[model samples]
Target: MFKIRNIGAILLVFFSISLVNAQIKIGDVLPNITLQDTKNNAVKLNSFKGKTVLVDFWASWCGPCRLANRKLVKMHDKYKAKNFEIVGISIDTDKSKWIKAIEKDKIQYVQLIDPKGFDAKSAVTFGVEALPATFLFDATGKLIAINPTESQIITQINKK
Candidate 1:
């Protein structure tokens, strides 16, 4: 009797988890990745240099992410004119559903679609292993916190 095991699959799983765990920390600048807006416009992370930006990694299929969008809408409205912005990078492969979610959620902030789902380049850049993952960055584009609450964003953005 011969026993066979898929070592490649095991290695892949191990390596993927490690990659997700290896994330950029506070004070580290988020890697500049270009994403597409609704109109397919190129939006680069570096373009938001002087604004306090929050990059929210989410998907249309995730309920928590949709729930978080409601709060994010409020935050964006309160801070948009004050040099604060929320860049929502959706990890949804379906553009139509992503747009529907945005419209339904009333997310007025910047909505970018990666269309690669969790395997999107933007997700990899941010090491996003979970939905609703948020990275808060200061005006200088340096990461200040992850999964930051409304209060934290309020405090940090107000400081600038």
Candidate 2:
């Protein structure tokens, strides 16, 4: 019985550590992940340093993600010239479907393919558990918000 209890305690501690490590909190530097764009060009998350960026994690099959993309499109247009950028990371394993959704949504921002669905490396690193998850980073690549609303994103972009 003592051995079983010890094993249970160890398992609990291991899971606790994992959960803590998975979280990417505000003020944490964005993870350095290299993913491919729609055109198959390698893009690194760190490359966006020196620019305010919104990293959006989404899937083509998610209806809420589609709606969020529409709002993001408008935000992109309004803020692109202001040095704000949006990086859409699709968690869709189907490349064609992901590209189709981008084209249909008229998304002009940088689009990346995760191809791992919810278990994508970036998603796991950032602890993204839901569709339409967004992380806002400052010009220095430090995270500012997580799952922020469209208005909250715009407000952050508009800040000096």
Error of 1 at 113 (Å): 1.2
Q: Write the per-residue lDDT of candidate 1 for residues 1-160, one digit (tens) a residue.
A: 1223577777889998888666677888867788889889998977887899999999999999989988889888888989998999998998999989988999888988888877887787787888989999999889999998788999988994
Model 2: per-residue Cα lDDT at residue 59: 87
Per-residue lDDT of 104-124 in model 2, one digit per residue for the tens? Answer: 999999999889987888888
Task: Spell out the clash pairs found in candidate 1.
Answer: none
TM-score quality measure for candidate 2 = 0.93
Residue 122 miss distance in model 2 (angstroms): 0.8
Q: In model 2, which runs have C-alpha deviations exceeding 4 angstroms?
A: none
Give the distance in Å from residue 63's predicted Cα in candidate 1 to where it truly belongs. 0.6
Counted clashes in each candidate structure = 0, 0
How close to the true structure is residue 76 of candidate 1, measured as C-alpha lDDT? Answer: 89
Question: In candidate 1, where is summed lDDT lowest over 10 consecutive residues?
Answer: 1-10
